[model samples]
Target: MNQTAPATLRSRLWWPSAAALTIAAAALGATLLLPRLFSDPVGVDPYVLRLTGVAIALAFVALVWSRFATVRPILLAVAAMTAAFSVFAGGPQWIENISGSRFDFNTQVLFASAAEALLTAVVAVLAVRTSPSTLRPLLRLRRFGPTALIATIVGVAVFVAVVMLLPATLLGREGIAPVALARDLPLQGPASVLQSFAQELQFRGLILGALDRVAPPWAANLGQAAFFGLAHIAVVYQGPGAAFVPVTIVLGFVLGWVTQRTGSLWPAIVIHAVADIAVTVGVIPGLYGY
Candidate 1:
C-alpha cells in the first residue's frame, strides 16, 4: 500500500493538470484585453501592450496556482512567449534606435537571440524531464513565501531610498538629468513597480525557475547568466564604447549568479531595477548627454 500511494497520487493529479491548462488558456486570452484598453491612452505607447500582457499572464498564473498547480508550466510558456515577443518588438529596435544605426538583424543581437532561445529551451526540457511530479517542474519552489515577499518589499524600499538619496557618483554616474526622456525614464513610481515585477517574473521566475529543476545548480546558474548577457546586448550598443559590451555581459553573469545564490529574485530584481533607474535617470544627461 505504501509503495502504491505515490503512484496513486500521481494519477489523481492528472485531472487537475487538465483543468489548469484550460485555465491558463482562458487567462491568456483575457490578456488581449490589455492592448485594446491601452491602444490610445495618454502618453502610452503601443509597445507597452507587451508588458501588460506579461503582467496579466502572471496574475492569472498566481490566481490558479493553488487550485491548479499545472498552471505553473503553462505560465512559463507564457513568459517565454512574452520574452520572445519583447525581443522581436523592442530588443532589436532599441539597439537600432540607440545606436543611431539602421535596422539590421545581421549583428550580435541575432546570435544572442538564438543562443538565449536554445539555452532556455534546453533548460525547460531538462526541468520537465527530471521532475517526478507534474507541477514540480514549475511550482515546486522552496517555500519562503513570507520571507521572500518581505525581502522583495524591503529591497524595493532600499532601492528607492538609494535612488533618491545616494549621490549619483556612487552609482558610477553624475546626476539626475537623463530622466528628461520620459518615454524611457518614465517618472512614475507605480510604473516602476510594475516594470520591476514584469522583469522578475520573466527572467528569474520563469527562466531561472525552469533551469532550477533540470540542470544541476551550477550549470543552471551559468546558463541563465549567459541568457542575461544576451538580453542586454542592446545596452552595450548604446554608444561608441564597443569595449563596454563585454562589461555589460559580465555584469549580467554576476546578476544571474546572485539570483542563483539567493534562490530568490528579490536581490537581482532590486539591484537591476536600481541600476536601470540610475542609468536612465541619473546619468545620460548628467554624463553621457541625451
Candidate 2:
C-alpha cells in the first residue's frame, strides 16, 4: 500500500509537469513562428515580440496548472497574453496598415473577428463538456424574470446614453447627420448585433465560466474583463492611448458582473449588442469628429 501510494502520487505529479512543459514549448514556438509567417519583418518590434513570447509561455503554464490548482492564475495569464498579442499581433489595425484600403480593413476585421468567435465557441463547448462539473446554460429564459428584464433595460439604457454622450463630453466631438446614420443603421445594426452575441458567448459564457470553476466569482469577472479590454485596444483607437483600455475594461467588468449575477449571458449579450449597434449607427461619433 505504501509503495502504491508513492507511485500514484509520482504519476499524478509527472503528468501535469509534462503537460506544462509541452504547452510552454508550444507557446514559445508559436510566438517565434507566428510573426515570421504572417508579419513583415521591418515593422515587427523585437521587444514586443520577445515579451509576447514570454507571456504566452507563462499563460500556457498557468492553463495547465488550472487543472490541478486555482484557475485565477490561468485567467491572469490569459489576460496578460491577450493584451500582448493584441498589441503585437492578431490585430486588424496592423492588417489595415498593410492592406491600405478601408474596404480591405473592414473585411479583414469582420472575417477575423467571426473566425475567432467561432473557434472560441467550439473550444469553450468542448471544455464544458469535458469538465466534471455542470455549467449553467448560456441562456436561461426561465431565470429571466421581471427583475432580470428590468436590469437588462436599465443596463442597455445606461450603456446607450454613455456612448451617445461620450463624444460631446470627453471627446469634444460634434454629432454627424442623423439622416446619414439612419441610412446605415439597417446594415450596421444586424452586423453589430451578431458580433456582440459572438463576443459574449466567447468571453463571458466560455472564458469567464471556465475560470469560475477554480476562482472566486470576482476574480473570474475581473480576469475576463481585463482580457476583453486588451482585445479592444487595436480595434478602438488609432494609436496607443490611456483612455481606451480603461473604458473597455470597465465596460467588460460591468458585462461580466451582469452575467454572473443573472446566472446567464443573455442580459450581458443584449446590452453589448445594443451598445455596439448604437455606436455603429453614429449615436456615438468618432473621436474629435474624425
Residue by residue across 1-290, what tens digits does model 1's lDDT show?
12112445545654443444345444544444344565633212544344436534663554455543434554454445444445534555667767666634434244334444554454345335433453444322344455556655665677578567867654445544343445444333333333444454445656545445444555545544554554443223344434445655565566566566555666666666666555545554454543
Backbone clashes per model, in order? 0, 0
Superposed Cα deviation of residue 1, candidate 2 (Å): 37
Residue 253's C-alpha lDDT in candidate 2? 93
Q: Where is model 2 more than 4 Å wrong at Cα?
A: 1-117, 134-143, 164-175, 234-242, 283-285, 288-290
Residue lDDT tens for model 2, 159-181? 76766656454543345677766
Whole-model lDDT for model 1 versus the true structure?
Answer: 0.49
| TM-score, one value per model | 0.44, 0.60
What lDDT does the true structure give each of the candidates? 0.49, 0.56
Alpha carbon deviation, residue 63, candidate 1 (Å)? 22
Clashing pairs in 1: none
